[model samples]
Target: MPVAPAASLRSVRTLRGPGPLGAQVPGSGGAYWARLLPLLAALACVTRLPSFRWPLWSPDEGYLAVQARILAHGGELYETVVDRKPPLVPWLYEGSFALFGDSSLLPLKVLAVTAQLLTAVLLASLARRRWGDGAGRTAGVLYLLISIGLNPQDAQAATFEIFMLPCTAAAMWCADRRRWGAAGVAVACALLAKQTGGAVLLPVAWLLWRDGASRRCVARIAAGLCGPVLAAALLTTPSGFVFWTVTGSGAYASFTGSELHVLGRGLVNALVLAGACAGIVPPVVRVLRVARTGAPELWLWLASSAAAVLLGFHFFGHYYLQLMPPLALLGTAALQILPRERTARAIVATGCSCAVFLAWGFLAPRPDLAHAARLAEAVESRTGPKDKVLVWGIHPETYWLADRAPASRYLTAGLLTNYSGGRNGPQVGEKYAVGGTWPVFREELRRHPPTLVIDDSRGKPYGPDRVPSLRRILAEGYRPVLRVEGAVVYARVGRGGEGEGAVRGG
Candidate 1:
């Protein structure tokens, strides 16, 4: 092992003390929790209250829940039930399902809440280390408040962005304290949670070079970064993991909207996000004002996060969640220099953001979970418990609602249609849907055809009418049984009834 030079040692000591980040704020004794508990409780209530009202929030949560159920029942990941994300999130969902039955989405909600709370705590700790107790509290509060400023789906759902935060925050926390190996492991853990988490390494790397870390320190960080990912690959289907996380990701990222649409949506997203996070404005301004004074690492962190947000080109509200923790930390550091009327500015900012989203929500239609519930009820009424169901379009919520297994590995029709999330229309991605998912879809249907096929793609670009194979399958072997809203239910002949009849509207 090599020794850190005297200058490096001094730098570490300085960071350990109150010079840069700040002396560790007093956290011992009863006084700490006494003051902090109310804030945490309020945060939990504000963030999760909406979650508890429903079993599921978004389609993303629905699919992930179904995937978790598949795993809980001894199904393999990527092979049995497929998704184009890294395995950790599904694994976490599996753990939640294992503990609490997969019958309800409460477990998943709980997991999301826990992740957010932990991230806030970690952010507070980070801020306190550099600033003071007040900054720590402010940072934690700002994170919790700003996190939930968006609509329930983006803010409350147990999505990838929500899970990635604590790991990334913790990584920086460790790096700031000069714990290289732990920091590396934390960064890798964040990546496992979400692909964008890989962006966290840039700031960490910059820290290493800036600190002039010893060769051994650098090696430890490298080992930490690679260790978990390699282990995950070894444990699961390595080929599947590589393909989904890397190759498939490329295809998904190939969405290139027209310049006009991109600019329009980008402006809207920016305004809404800025409004929602209005409270953070003072800290943001203060931090930028003193950007050269210290904490270049935080600026790097924010820059990298910004790059990650733009990587997809579709700037969804949740995408902006990645920017909050770094902002909170930097903002907290500038607490000493914050100008007057900070609270009033935050309140006004909050009002503006809320109004923007509220107006947007009213103007634009949101997916009604009630319709899904109705569809689920109809499917459940007609089908037996053992029968598997296949849902067309992106309505995986149907499968979760009906409490049925999916007939195919492709949970949604996106792969079949090459209709990924970012783009508005169902056009093929940069390359054709990774390795031709249609063949796999056909084979799966051939071997084990679904008892009930819910066609939720009536008006969609990838609707059955547009896809020849799907249309033929519907016409030949299946008959329409029921229609609920836009969704048309088809049942396999001989299984559904004596003879084909006109589909009856629900």
Candidate 2:
């Protein structure tokens, strides 16, 4: 592509008059990227897709994918294979698997990238409504930078937060337009993505109610909120939806998400995000100072979403992913509010351009996923397609790569023990003893009896003496067959069990 001259960039400064600082031609005539900033931002997202040829970094990625794999093959969600989250994320994974097949990471990457790009577009449009063209473009660019750089561990995966963003952005945009009905529907869809999405409804509803919307409009908004929720509820048996999404949810978060133990761990993550937003802090303050700010709902959104970032109790990277939208808006305003002097604006734009480049360049590397392939190698040596295996830890990637069914339906033992520790939120009652469905886990193990068990030590915290039956089952029924990457494997003693020996690597 031919490089446009530096002067061309100046033409993007949209103005009230049809002069030099006005709109340019539609074609690729110098300042094309400026006019098509949103479109370009989306395409940039697509082009900047992460390298999929690595091992999965976050356990949640594999966990959700495994659930999707199960669902794709006709297994039930909460009843058969379990997770405490709402059903939307896994369903999207299910859809991707149907389209791209479950074997490659490409499907998940594609799904995440597409959703992220759409979010960028919506976010930019929303910023433009409240700010201006400069802020809109700036928001789009900053969101892309911060999202991809936020948490290298979870950023690349098709995380629930990633999917929720477009819905949240759309809802905020609709509310900005006083399209109360559309905003309500958008937030309902957001809830389907992840429960944190429910927070978005606060800002939307507050705006509608504060604006003195007509009673008919209020009813329309309420109907939109109820419609999607009711439809999603009808998809599952009423009992299951109530139990998993609500009851089980409270149990799950109580321990894993809301526990104080995770606070210290998350503090660093919060700092990192804050540092990333450092450039925009000044502008954010400035934008807020204006009494008649166009995007008044942003303050409420910031309050709700920022509160959500803290409420989850856990400091997981993806949890912080919830803060991107508000940060992007504020950051965009910061970028746009610079001095109108040509030299000052030019210098600021140049600095921002370099910042985006530096962030993308530096944050592109992923965690070593190569070891997972090795584990898959060693695992496939001992198991086959029909044979079930227990990831006695948190490495669900093993199950995905080996193409085997999870012997224990729960993702990790941590979830099970969470309830016992009183860290249990709503879901991990006696049913999902740890982090999953405990009774079903035990039944699955006893009835099917996995051919091999990969004793992932992550699930090792037996917690206040651990479950005695589980200890006995492992001690008497399974024997250690191998060890790899600090993960030990225990093969079922009688069901095509291997001799007592350890193969160091797969």
TM-score of each: 0.89, 0.82
- lDDT tens readout by residue for model 2, 55-143: 45566788887998999888887777776677888888888889888887676776677777777777776665554555556667667
lDDT of each: 0.75, 0.65
TM-score of predicted model 1? 0.89
Give each model's clash number: 5, 23
By summed lDDT, the worst window of 10 consecutive residues in model 1 runs over 7-16
Poorly placed runs, candidate 2 (over 4 Å): 1-34, 37-39, 46-48, 51-55, 255-261, 286-294, 334-338, 341-368, 419-436, 458-460, 463-465, 497-506
* Span of 10 residues, lowest total lDDT, candidate 2: 14-23
CA error at residue 193 for candidate 2, angstroms: 0.5
Compose the digit string of candidate 1's lDDT tens values, residues 1-506: 33346633433332233654344566673676568757876675555666666677688888888898888888888788788888888888888878887888787777788888889888877776665566667778767766766666777678788899999998988887788999999999999998899899988887788678789999999999999999988877999888878776664676554445555676776665676676776665644443333567877898999998888676676777898788766555554454446644654565456545444443443456888888899888877888898988786888888888899888887776666554555354323465757778788888998888889876767777778888888888898878999789998998636227778998
Return the lDDT, model 2, position 120.
Answer: 79
